[model samples]
Target: MSHPIIRVAIADDHPVIRMGIEAAIDEIPTLSCIGAVGDSSALVALLEQSACDVVVTDYAMPGGAFGDGLQLLDHLRTHFPDLRLIVMTGLDQPAMIQALHASGIDHILSKADDTSHVPAAIAAAWANRRYLSPSITQLLPARGAPRAIAALSPREHEVLVLFVSGLSVNEIATRLDRRKQTISTQKTAGMAKLGIDKDADLFKFASELGLRTARPDTE
Candidate 1:
């Protein structure tokens, strides 16, 4: 007799996407967007402070002093184990999706995905079901994900991911805040460790690393 009550949170540095999500949730019958954050630190605070059943967040947040979506995912998984997650990113790769899959991300949506699919993705995550944007399903290359992931050292792994995301050695340097040469060496070492040969291979490797699946482990 009563519709389900789903309190939701959204995080993204982008205005259009955040506005779109807020608008959509406002129109939905049983859902509410309670907290919307522009930066990762704000997101963490919102999570700790708000009451919500699911949190939908952008995969990459620019101007986010803490832009690593994976890190937020990990923190949520660690501190709010019962909270559900929907991960949306413009970067859809086999490795990234697979990593999110392993980390128990309930839904994976692409920004280019149909807007109608957003509500459905939220519903699936609320139900503890999984959904992925069709484009993500089709385009994510699964071939190298597992092998490449197994080969990465933790730091090299982090460097490899930032590198492949088109972050320059300097940007990566700035994000990681290391010296330019240090970032260069890390890139070189990560490349050697992963045997990344070309841009194509670089993408394949990023996919498996599950940069989206950065959930913290309790055990």
Candidate 2:
């Protein structure tokens, strides 16, 4: 008996990236590229019209009726709770990674890293397992002094992580679905608990705590 083919969709703003992912999917006998879209709106439209086993998408695609980044992810999670999503992006900051995980994305791939693992990521997602790029795994906070991250409440920790990841107060507020003032208060409280008084100090503290550098290496 033949196993069912896994119908996959690719969503990214760049045509080249979409094509590359499609080609990768084509190489796998059990997987088929059912849709390739440039934005979240198109992705949603395609999903409404067909069944897809997995969706591989960019994290920061702009110019769509449904928005992008965390918003797009949130929309998909809310509307299509059963769809498996694999986010492939250059945004590998720890806070963003944490947020994506919290948002129910089980697979993440780094655009700056090699694409050889794309097939593996898809396979893992198809099997309902989590897959994080090695580059992303390295960015997670190392096991160390428990008090470093334990001092803050869950919301506070989230705020601090996003802040340290370089998201502005308003942007984080928008992403977390909280008011600007609430996010500001959480930032202040979290920083106070961590004894971080300045932006530079916060970055330094986060670095020491094992958050990866956000800068991509230049070739």
Candidate 3:
């Protein structure tokens, strides 16, 4: 039996990137490029009007009804619960990678990496598996390294989990029924315990410790 076609969409600010990805999608037998848009607003509008199985988007795209980065991802996740996302970006920062993972994006391809992996990434996302480009994987803490979560107090761990799961400090405080300052303190303490001084490192640590919102079935 023939496999069902996977309707895919592309969103990137650069026309070259969008067209390149569209061309790649055309080469895959089971994948179809249903829409290619320049901004998140256009992408959202297309999604609302059409059916799409997967979305390959640039993380840093700006000027949309919803702006880019985590804001765009959050909006998409909230509005389209079942849509599979594949992020294609030049950002290979440890913290950003961790944040993407925390936000439940399973397939991430660095723009610097081989485009040949794009098809694989899309397939993996559809299968509920994760595909991280080599550039991103190289930034992860070495496996078997001591996990920072072990050093955290229970409250600190709780706060870190919520924060990495894409909650703002104020939101976390509201959910935990604690003062925002208290939540901030706990977050700081947890990061310190983990030797993490940057926001990205906190996300990296949480991701390494499996503290994100959704765990991938496969790496």
Candidate 4:
């Protein structure tokens, strides 16, 4: 029997991020930034003093214990169970994402996401919908079917390892002492057979297959 506007608060260490989000929030007629705090203590203090429809919290502060966001969420739930939470961070791993999803974080957005997507995630948080960015969602393991085990030639698997580790065709060629065109053809064939397009996806799939030794791409 009541129309409730979405009350929003922000807790992030960066002033620039807060400003950017506030600037974006201004364009949305349905939402407003009623409070913005920096760090965990400020965040907890504000949430205790005021009732917010949603809290846009960051993963860490200048001095936060690990899993600080989860701790804060647990605290918020104890006091204000009805408050909608939208946890956001730059961390983009399936295990971390799965943990956040299971922990009552309704909406998760990656900082690497394009600016236009922020508003949609916020709106979904307000609507109590599961908001997943295309980039982040794609990292989630497939549903309903186990991946087919490809019996790649040992060389094919070896090349895929370097390829996923961010080696360009030329780099892979140099690293493996092979011709560039040959390595390129192999990578292309692997991509087609694996149904993967980008190197990032290739890395994720390789990691899922229990190959987790990407050296962070020296080249």
Candidate 5:
């Protein structure tokens, strides 16, 4: 039996990566390239204007109105709950990959893997199954992810979430209506609890735990 054509959209900050994904889609007889855009805003606009079955989006496409990383992914998941999403990310960190799964993203393709994996990810996502590329798969077990995140106090959880969501300590303080020193201390304490020393590792850890939606009391 012949399969129905799957309409696909590509969203990546790099023009070359977008072109590569489009090219891959063109080679698949059952897949059609609907639209390709550079950032989150354009992707959102494209989805609004057109219908597609699957989206292959970059993990870190900064400079868009919706921001990037977990923030962009959360927006897409929230607004397009029924849409099949295939995330393409160069961040091979185990925590981040686990976080993507925690956020209900079942398809993740490593950019380091060939663009050929794009079609496979699309197929899996369309069928409501999980698919992770070779590199991303190897990065797992992602052990202790849950316990580490659960160790944080509510306030520390709130601070870490805001920090990884791209807010500085000062910005998070203003947003939460707290003193900057308090925010900084919470961030530091959270990192210590998570056993994360560097800011980069903290981003990975926080992302893995799906903390973007955490709402602790601000008062």
Candidate 6:
């Protein structure tokens, strides 16, 4: 007996990553790469033009009008609920893991996993089954580490986005109509919840998580 083809779409900000996934999909007999896009806008366009059953997307894909991270996922869920989604990420932050799970994502793959797992995940998703890559399974906090759900509140998210976007505490307070000390406290608390300390690491964390609306405007 034979199975129907599963048309797949790839969404990632990195061209190299997209190409690799495209090649992997091409190698599978039952899987077809319908399109590969570098951002959410192009992904949306491709889906609208082509018939795609599954989407393999990076969690941190930015540079799109729809934005990335939870925002992008929400857009997909709302517009393409039937499409099977496989989220790929490099971060192991418990808060992020909790957020993704809370969003009802079934297949989460860590970038550290071998590319071969991508085919396995695609097959599982096409079958309507949950599949977590080995690396992703290891990253799951349930395996021993405290299952922390330090999800930032709405205000904390806003404060961190502005801070990571290159705004000073005073500037953020002014823009948000909050006190400078309050903004500082929120920023510090957000960093602590994410297990980050230094400013450079905070910027990297925000970028990796797509917390900012976009990349920092200034260097």
Which parts of model 2 are misplaced by more than 4 Å?
Answer: 142-219
Off by over 4 Å in 4: 1-3, 62-67, 144-219
lDDT of 5 at 57: 94
TM-score of each: 0.66, 0.66, 0.66, 0.60, 0.71, 0.71
What would the TM-score be for candidate 6 when compared with the true structure?
0.71
**Model 2, C-alpha of 57: deviation from truth (Å):** 0.7
CA lDDT of every candidate: 0.71, 0.77, 0.79, 0.67, 0.81, 0.80
Screening candidate 3 with a backbone cut-off below 3 angstroms (N, C-alpha, C), the clashing residue pairs are: none
By lDDT, who's the top model here? 5
Candidate 1 per-residue lDDT, tens place, 1-219, comes to 998889999888888889888888887889988878887888878877888898888876756555555666777788888888888887644445556566666588888886677788889888777788787676444442243365556666676667676787789779876799987876677666544545565664465454434522221
Model 5 agreement with the true structure over 32-80: per-residue lDDT tens digits: 9889999989999999898888989998888789987778878888998
Candidate 5: what lDDT? 0.81
lDDT-superior candidate, 1 or 6? 6
Off by over 4 Å in 6: 143-147, 150-193, 198-219
Clashes of each: 4, 0, 0, 0, 1, 0
Name the weakest run of 10 consecutive residues (lDDT summed) in model 4.
144-153
| Decreasing TM-score order of the candidates | 5, 6, 3, 2, 1, 4
Model 3 lDDT on a 0 to 1 scale:
0.79
Candidate 6 local lDDT, 153-191, one digit each (tens): 667777888888889999999988889999999889877
- lDDT accuracy of residue 98 in candidate 5: 61
lDDT, candidate 4, 3-109, per-residue tens: 46777888888888887777777787777788887787787777778778888777655564323556667877787888777766776555445545655565777
| lDDT of candidate 3 over 4-86, digit per residue (tens) | 89999999999998888988888899999989999999999999999999999998898998988777888888999889999
